[model samples]
Target: MTTCPLCGFEFDGTALSCHASCAFNERCAVICCPNCGYQMVDEQRSVVADRLRRWLARRNPPVREIGEVCALTELRPGQTGRVIEIDAENPVRSERLQVLGFVKDAEVYLLQTKPTYIVRVGFTEVSVEQSIGAGIKVLVG
Candidate 1:
């Protein structure tokens, strides 16, 4: 069985071999996951890559639940969460926030939520207004 890197779906490669009729089937080593349609190279075709993938997967399992996601402002004081999404109305503001350490997958710790929302992302502590804090979503699990 093979596991998808993106969605963690596992299945036998041959079960989804509907790509046999494609023009590039002979040269293409890609396999598409039935669950999420994520195309990835078939690891069996490369022994080195297969071994590395297995090793990495063992170190960090591909399968993991995203858990509950909510606005950063919803987190209670002293709570920590993984930043999942930033719903900034402006693209420039979203990019700015990312540069300021509010990027997705970054861990955010709620320090306070009174006059302003104080969050610690990595080693940087940022004081944000309620509107900005509400735009940042984090995984609460």
Candidate 2:
């Protein structure tokens, strides 16, 4: 995955493939972020740097939640959860939810429960009607 340093769009990684017959082509160590077209050098590792990177990667694991299991409709205002799954059996519906950033392990918060289920995911708020909201299972304490 490539994360753009400029726009923060985490999309597929696009690497520049050199077709030119150059002596340095095999030794080129660069990665380009697909979203913003930003380029950065892929580390040409020294022994010490490699060791340090491995250690650091091990030291700081990504923040994740085991999540307290619960239903989305049951959550009151101000409740939060990591979206573990959407219970919709239809693949299209599941894909739709994923596109809306309702995939597994995404943190979500209930902003309101009246009229519709208004929830916040990341920096965006989404209003889901009861039929849809009921199928969205969340992991909240």
Candidate 3:
């Protein structure tokens, strides 16, 4: 199950639909926001190559991890961090992360891990995983 990026409502992964005009179909990618209607196109192979070039430009980057920090403690459980990179090879996780606001500079905190990972962003908590979490870059302040 995954949560709607805009509304924060839980849903089955199969229920998500990508925005029209998006290059990839729904099954190949994560669902768009039911509330805000946000969706991202799957990057073409050339796009992936370009992104790889950008990734290579960075020096000594941290390994990507999934999950979030404990809401109460603000410490990462076993899986949680800022999304500094993306592996477009997996479209579902990559698109899902984008939908959930896991982009750079966004703050994510892990709340719980049971049926799924409960994450906190600002005042809202939602369930997600490495598929999306790995792309986020976390910071301690």
TM-score of each: 0.52, 0.50, 0.34
Best by TM-score: 1
Q: Backbone collision count in every prediction?
A: 0, 0, 11
Q: What is the lDDT of residue 136 in candidate 1?
A: 91
Better of 1 and 3 by lDDT: 1
78 in model 3: Cα distance from truth in Å? Answer: 12
Candidate lDDT scores, in order, read 0.81, 0.73, 0.53
lDDT of 1: 0.81
lDDT of 1 by residue, 25-131 (tens): 65556788999999887766656688898897665423223476778877778778899889999999899899989987999988988778898989999999989
* Model 2 per-residue lDDT at 11: 63
Extract clashing residue pairs from model 1.
Answer: none
Predicted candidate 3 versus true structure: per-residue lDDT over 76-121, tens digit per residue: 4443455445545678866776776766656666666555557776
TM-score of 1: 0.52
Best-matching candidate per lDDT: 1
21-84, model 2: which lDDT tens digit per residue?
A: 5455755555556556676655642355577889988754343344657678767777788887
By summed lDDT, the worst window of 10 consecutive residues in model 3 runs over 65-74
Between 2 and 3, whose TM-score is larger? 2
